[model samples]
Target: MTCSEKMGSFYSGITCQDIPPHVMKKARLTLFDFLCVLRLGAKYTVINPIIKRYLVSLEHPEKYTVLGLKMKSSLEHAVLGMSVVSHGVELDDGHLSSATHPAVAVIPAALAMAEKCHSNLRDLLVSIVVGYDCMIRFAKAINPKHLSLGFHSTSTCGTLGAACAAGWLLGLDSEQLSHALGIAALQSAGLQEMLHENASIKPFQVGKSSSAGIIAAELAALGSKSPSKVFEGQYGWFNAMSNNDYRETDLWDRLGKHWMIMDTYVKLYPSCRYAHAAIDSALELYDEGYRMSNVKNVKLYLFQQGINEVGVFKVPSQYEDALFSVAYSIAIAFQYGKVRIEEIASNLQNTRILEFADNIDIISDKQMTDSFPREAGSRIIFEDDNGNIVVRENKRARADFDTPLTDEEYLLKAAQILENVVHRKYIDVLWEKVVLSDQKMDVKEIIELMNEMGA
Candidate 1:
């Protein structure tokens, strides 16, 4: 079978029971994380507001609730807005191998489509699993080369994932879903240049991917025809996007035996995933009683991809700048012994943090470069004026597939993330009514609760 047909059949065939219990549990955690991040992200001063304003200006038909906005919108508008909001804080769940943020790209579209179609909890969850698999597979086949080519995997590959999710929720047959996947492939567009030219475009691409995916699925449901060989065709996604530099990995080796969502990592800090190991190492130094006062200079060694993405030594002038800067993230870790949203927001202009960030140097290490997108390792060395030196290395970040966070840890992260943005009572109710429960949920009710309670 062709790549799109294989993926279309797989994405269209998954059911709630076919998904293992552990995979469903992971889906619940991802959904809960997405909701929390979406709520907190609405309060962001940058990208969310621009999206909200632009959507409101369009005045799309009101069909669904926009979380944290206290407004109603069409399914497309809601999906676009929620998807963008989820990534606003930079804490969305990401997969290492795929190099994409799956939740932001998948959940918003799936949930919005579920609500629109009145799909049960089973359909929603199953669609999520399928979406992650399709999106991650597309990315795993093309990235870090795709990323090296200045394409944002989350935005590009995510489009296909979102289409798979929406098509499954819409009950499209395998053939129809193939068309949806093809349409989504044609619509895929995101640039890593957004990281420098405008960070707002990062989340904007995510939102657009989700919205465009829904449109693709809807078009396919209307019996629209699409190119069949969207993946392996002569001038298709693999060739055009990856410049024929894609890997030939088995896209369906284990299939249901190995769900891609299981390999996804949850973020502990609200910065780029590349910066997480550096932050973790810095916190370890802080825990060892190494304060900034005693440290003279710091050097961080990271993989080439990490250095290319977040290892810049520039001082952050705003919140967006800080999110992608390993130097700034580490500075926050050492200065406060933690990297919290509050610390990031309050210290954007702090001279101490900026000065410390200036002293920090990020170097690309050959060993780490060779092991990247798998190990994501980082090494840090600290020196004192008197020649005292300390070194630490993190082979992999916490919350990785191997070192997954417990359910309690996930809940605690939710609380920590939402403490300032959402009311305490709402957080409690959400945890109990939505996340902790396994029963079928009224999708509309959950969306309503989010609309009323978020922000």
Candidate 2:
């Protein structure tokens, strides 16, 4: 069978029994991380407004609870709302190979479909796992070139992942699932131009991709038919968008044996993943008592890929710019002792921060540049007023799956977000159930608990 056929067959054949205990544990952690990030986005000015606007436009409200918001929206609207919130802070889980935010795309779609279909807890979790797996696998299949070719992977690959998850939730077999993917592929579109212009449309890509995936799955359920070979056919996704030689076998090489959800990196900082290593290096220096005032010059060495990704902002004047700006992130870390979600909102143009950012120089270090994608590393050199120099290097940040945050640390992060949206007592109670529940609880129950807390 062709790659697309094999993938379709694999998705159709896989069952909960196929998932190992360790993989399921990782999936649960991912779900927790997703909820935490979504809550954090609830407090973001940009995210709340978009969610409010979308919620206000819902034609017929459903029973699904929009996270953090006390309102109910249509399934489509709910998916859109949740997606915006998930991506609002840009802190969602990301697949390094595809460079797509899988949770942002998959979780929203899964939640919306679960509410509408009245799926149980097991169903909800499986759908999320399936969605993340499909999205990341497709993204890995179309690697660096798809992202480099000016298509936003989060939107493009996310759409396909959303479709797969939605299809699974709706119980579509291989044939119908294939059609859903094809339909979603046609609707999948997000330009990297938003990055070039530094616009707010970047986060919207997640919502759009997720909503489109739901639409595709619904169409397929209604007996729609589309091309099955959406990935590796002669004029398929890879060839059309990537403009590179296509390999169909890469799509299903180790399908069930390797779970992509485990490969995702959870963000410690709320900024871009490309900037994490630089932030790590800066934070290390600070923890070692490196003061900002004493530093005369700050130099950063990163991989060529890092330079291409986070090195865009020469002089960022705004919060969004700062998120994408390695120079700005490094400077903020040096000046403020750390970078937080709040730091992105605080005026970035503060003279001290700007002055430090201006003194920041970023260059591609050949040694680090050669090992990129395999490893994200950075080196920071600080020169003191007395001409003393301190250098710190970090190969990767702590939030990666390889070096995951402790349970307490993860819950603390979650609590910080939950405290902002709901009451502190609710955070403690809900966290108790979430962390220690023997049997999985329904997602709706979780939402209901939050609603009660708000009430």
Candidate 3:
């Protein structure tokens, strides 16, 4: 069988009953995280309002509701808008192995499709599991190389994931799902160049992939044919995208037995995943009584990839720059001993953060570079005016599977995002509905609950 066929056959057969209880639990957690980030992004981020207004101006058929907003639009546009909003703040769930954000890409497409089809909660959960599997497997198979080649796998591999979820919701069989994957492969696109340019439209690229995935699945359901060997053909995705630098084992190893959603992570900070380890390490130094006023110089050591990405931004003027800047995050961690949305937003004009950011130097360490994609480690050196230095290093960030957040931690995070934006009652109800309840529920109920919120 071709790559897409094998993946489709395995994933299309995964019903809610077949999914293990643990995997379902992880799916709920990620779903809750997605909704929380979606709300925060819509209300807090500047880009979401502009995108919503543009979509509203288009005046497409108001068949679907955009979460955290009072507007409704067509299915594709609604998913597009919501996907952008979900990733707007960079606090959405991500996978280290693939170096991609799956929930932001997959959940919005799946949720919109589920609402359009009135799918049951069980099926929605199953689709989410399979979607994460497809997206992470494809990216893990081809990346570090795929990512090094300047492609944004969240939009590239994420298109296939979104297609599978939407196709499953539409009741597509294995064959149709394979066709959808093939169609999505042709539509997959995004770049890492935006990071260099400091563009805020990075989230828009993610949203376009979600929209493309939905279109691909709809076309496949209508009998549109596509190449079955879309992943392995001579001119297929692997060769064309990964330059043939990929691992076959990463694609199919323990496919049905090991769920990729279990390997995913939820973020506590609204910054690039690469910068989290450094922030954590810096916070540790702060705990040891190293205030910004006492520190004379700072040095941060990170993987070459991390340095290549986050280390580029020394000073941040806007949201995108601040989210991707390791120096700014470290400065925030030292200056405030915390990095939250309000802290980051309010400190952009603070001369202290800017000065501390300027004094911090980022270095690429070979040891850290080799440990990447498994553990995003960092080492920090702080030197005081008296010539005394303190160093701290973290092998990994705090929110990985080994150091997973507690149920209470997840709830606290959700409450922080939903506070003052939605009623406290709605937040509790959403938590119960998504993470606690298993009763027969239509996806539209979730949509209606979210519609009560607005930016």
Candidate 4:
């Protein structure tokens, strides 16, 4: 069987009962995080303008609900608008091995379809899990190399993965699911060039991928036919985009045995995953009695993949670019002992962050290449003013840990996001729908809940 066949078979055979309890728990946790982020994302100073443009330009009647907004939008526009904001804030969940943000793209696409089809939350959970599995596996299989080839795996693989989830929710048969995958595969495109400097196109990649998934699935349901060899055929995703050979079967073999949804991690900082290890290590150094003043110079030894993505834009010339900078993240984390959204905004070009960030050098480490994509390891060498040197390594990145967030942590994240914009009632409704419930949810009601207090 080809990749799509194997995937379609799994989608057809898998049921909510077949998902393990732990995987279900992670799925819910992932959803909770996505909801919290979107609540804050819709109001971002940068993204809100883009939202208004679409709202004004399209101005269509309500078909699906856009989170944190009163106006309803058509399904594709709704998915596109919500996904752009969801990931625009840069606090969304990601699978480290494949380096894809599955939840941001997959969840929005799934929710839009659910609202349109009147599907329940139980089925929504199934679709999300299946999407994560397909996306992360494909990403992990080809990336680092896929990234070196200049393709953003998140958007490229994301289109296909979200299609799986969307197709499943729309009740596409095995053949139709494969057809949807083929349609999405052809639409896949996202470049790392957006990471260069303050480009607003970053979140649009996820938005387009999510919207493409729904559109592809809809087209497939309307009798679209495509090749089963879409993933590995001549001039297929692997042959055309990958810089190295990718074998998808082994990753697929571990699918049911290992849930990729569980492997995906949440970010404590709203920066690129490439810079996460350095942030974690810098925070630890501060805790170990090493202040920014105590440090003379800092050097980061990252894998080639990390260096390629984040090293070029070392010191962010603009606010949004800070999310993709190693120096900026390390400097901010070391300066304030934490990285926050407000700091990135208010202190985008703060002299302190710039001074520290300028002294930091990011060098590509060839030796560490083997541990990348799968492990996301990094080494930090610190030189203090007193001539005392500290070398620290973050091997088991904080983002990919096995434990889920506690109840307090979950609520705190939500409250932090909902701090200045919405009322307590907004959070109350959000918490109930995302954290406290497990029954079949009418997705439209979920949208209504967001607008309870006129969000």
Candidate 5:
């Protein structure tokens, strides 16, 4: 069978009962994290251009709620806003295996489609699982090469994934769902060139992808036809997007059997997942008495993926560059004891952080390749005046499935992200009303609650 057929059948087969409780919890946090980032990102200047370009001049239909803005928006515009915000902060949930920001691409699209269909919490969770599974699995089928080929996996794979969720919500049959996937695949657009140039297009691509999913589904339902063999055709996404040396792996290997959200990694720090392992090691060292005071130079023996993405920028000059800069992320960790959006934004001219970041080295090593995606493993070396004060190697990030964040931690994180933007009472209400429970949710009501609770 064709890849599209396989995935369409898979999406058609999954029921709310097919998903486990733990996966449900993971899906809830995935949704919650998207909301948190949306709350925090609403204030960013980066978000202004998008809002003005879309919401200011164009009229909104007042069908859905944007996280912070009081203006009611259509489902497409709402998803667009959510996608922009979720990816804007760099705090979105990631699928390690696919190297794609899963939640930013999937959750927003799911929310928009769910809102449109008035889908319950159970089906919403199930749709998210299908969407995430489709995206991450397709990404895995054409990864490091997909990165190497200059395509951002989040946008490319997310298009198809979002289509699955949207198609499911819109009640599209397998054939229509296949067409939706095809049309969504046709809309796949993202380039890593922005990473090198410090452009905002990366997040914009995610926003576009999120909206495109529903559009594809709507068009498909209206009898739009596309290449059914969009995935494994002679010029399929994998080979067309990646290097010619591509083999289409089982993108739908376990589909309904194992959910993808269960394997997602939550960002403990608001930076690239690539820097998480090294940052964790640095923090652990500080905890073990290797404080940031006497550090001279730091070395990170990183997986190929990490080295490829964040290795070049020793010092970032613009807003986007700093977000992707390995040195900038690690510097903020050691110097400020955390990686905050303000630190990266306001400290662009901080010489001390720049010099320290310049002292850091990210070397690509093959030993960590096997553990890559599944684990963002790193080996770190710290040099101080005392000479080689610490050496940390062979460690993966803590947010892996084994050491997942607790409910208390997620609530605290939610409170922290919302502390400055939304009131504490609303944050608590949101946690109790939406995230903590597994009941049918009126997304519009939650949005109203947040709007009422905004500081």
Candidate 6:
């Protein structure tokens, strides 16, 4: 079968039992990471205003946790709320190969749907694995150059993943699932132009795509018919959007044998994934006790892919720009020795960060450029005042799944986020329930608990 055919079959036929144990464990970690990011995102200047505006306009009550907030909305509203929280901070998980924020797009839909259905924890876990699988598979089929051409994978591939997860949870047959995929394909949209304009529409793309996928699945379940060959038919997604043909067999090459979730990397810093390696390199120089002032110039050697994505910010005037700027991220890490979420939000425009950013230079290495997709690496060289030199090269950061955060560290991060958005006591309770419990809880009860905790 072609890649598209294999993916179609997997989404249409895979059952909960088909999920491997290692995949399930990774899914759980993803869940915890998603919640942590969501909680922290609730306070993001861009995300909070929109969520509050929507909540104020609501006339009826519904069930579903709105991350750190206490307000509950309908299932659809819940998906939107959670999605905004997930993507607002730009701290969600991203695929190293695809450069797509799969969890941000897929997790919100799964959580909203699972809450609406009151599905068991096992079922929820299974749905997340399936959702991630579909998202990564679709992303893998597309060319990275397509994104450079202004397409946003978070919305495009994310919609298909959301549809697959919703279809699975809704108990739709393979035919209905295919129909849902077709419906989802029609609604997918997000563009790289938002980054250029520094618009807040980026997160909206994630929420909109996610909610749209749920709507597609619901319509399919209600007997709505859509084109069967949404992926491979003439003038379909690949041909229309990318102008490239895909090998459909690549979609299910390993199926259950290899898990996509295991390849996902969590963020230690609340910046773009493209900026992480540079930040790591700069941090290493700091750990070696190099003074920022003594550094005459800093040169960053990055893969072409990283440069294309984050090298846009030659001079960043705002927080969003700084987040996407390799120069800014490296400068801040070298100056302060660390990059935290609060620092990104508040100090992106600080005079010191700007001055340091001015001294930083970024260049692409042809050798490193050749290793694209399979790995993300960076090399930093520092020139000191006395003609001294220091260098550090990191193949990958610690947050990569292969070198994941410890359980205590994960919980501590989660707790810190909760403390920022909700009451400490409530966060403690919710943490216990999410981490220790095996039974499913009502979506309504979950919302109520968050409300009591000052949602």
Each prediction's Cα lDDT score? 0.84, 0.76, 0.86, 0.79, 0.76, 0.74
Looking at candidate 2, what is the lDDT of residue 346?
80
TM-score winner, 3 or 5? 3
Error of 6 at 448 (Å): 4.8
Provide the lDDT at 242 for model 4: 83
lDDT of 1: 0.84
TM-score of 1: 0.97
**lDDT for position 251 in model 4:** 61
lDDT of 5 by residue, 1-455 (tens): 77777777768667778888878878777777667777777765375465646775677678776555556577777777778866877878887767788788888778778777777777777788888888888888887678778888898888888888888888888888888888888889888777777566678888888888878888998999888778667887655877545546546566667877787878876677888788787777666666557887688788887776777677888777777787787777777675677778888898888888887877888878777766677888878767855788646776776688898888877777666676777777777766766467666666666577651
Question: TM-score for every candidate vs. truth?
Answer: 0.97, 0.93, 0.97, 0.93, 0.93, 0.91
Better of 1 and 4 by TM-score: 1
lDDT for 33 in candidate 5 is: 69
Once fitted onto the true fold, the runs of candidate 6 whose alpha carbons sit more than 4 angstroms away are 1-9, 54-65, 415-431, 439-455
- lDDT of candidate 2 over 1-455, digit per residue (tens): 55445655677667778878777767767777787677767776365675676678756656666775657787776787788777878788887767788998998898889878877666777788888888887777776778677778899888888988888889988877878888888887888777656555677888889989998899989998777666666787878768755354556667788888888888877777878988988877777776677776778899877877678875676666666778878777876776777776685658777777777888889988667666788898878777888788888766786777777877777765555466667666766655556535666776676557652
Task: Please give me the total number of clashing residue pairs in predicted model 3.
Answer: 0
- TM-score quality measure for candidate 4: 0.93
Where model 1 places Cα greater than 4 Å from the true spot, the runs are none
What is the C-alpha lDDT profile of model 4 across 1-455, one tens digit per residue? Answer: 88778777777677788899788878878887887787667766366576757775887877788775556788888888778878877888887767788987899888888888888778888889998887888788886678777888889988887898889888998888888988998899999888875566788888899899889899999999778888788878778778437766546666687788887788777777877888899889888878778887788999888887767767787767777778888887777887777777667758887888888878777767787766666888978887988899986567464755676787776777667767777777776876568648766666777666444
- Following a full C-alpha superposition, what root-mean-square deviation does model 2 have from the true structure? 2.2
lDDT score of residue 212 within candidate 3: 91
**Candidate 2: segments with Cα more than 4 A from true spot:** 45-47, 61-63, 246-249, 416-423, 452-455
Pairs that clash in candidate 3: none
User: Against the hidden true structure, what lDDT does model 5 obtain?
Assistant: 0.76
lDDT of 3 at 262: 90
Model 3, range 102-174, lDDT digits (tens) per residue?
A: 9988998999899888887778888898888999999999988998999998999889999999998898999
Report lDDT (Cα) of residue 169, candidate 5: 82
- The model with the greatest lDDT is 3
lDDT of 6: 0.74
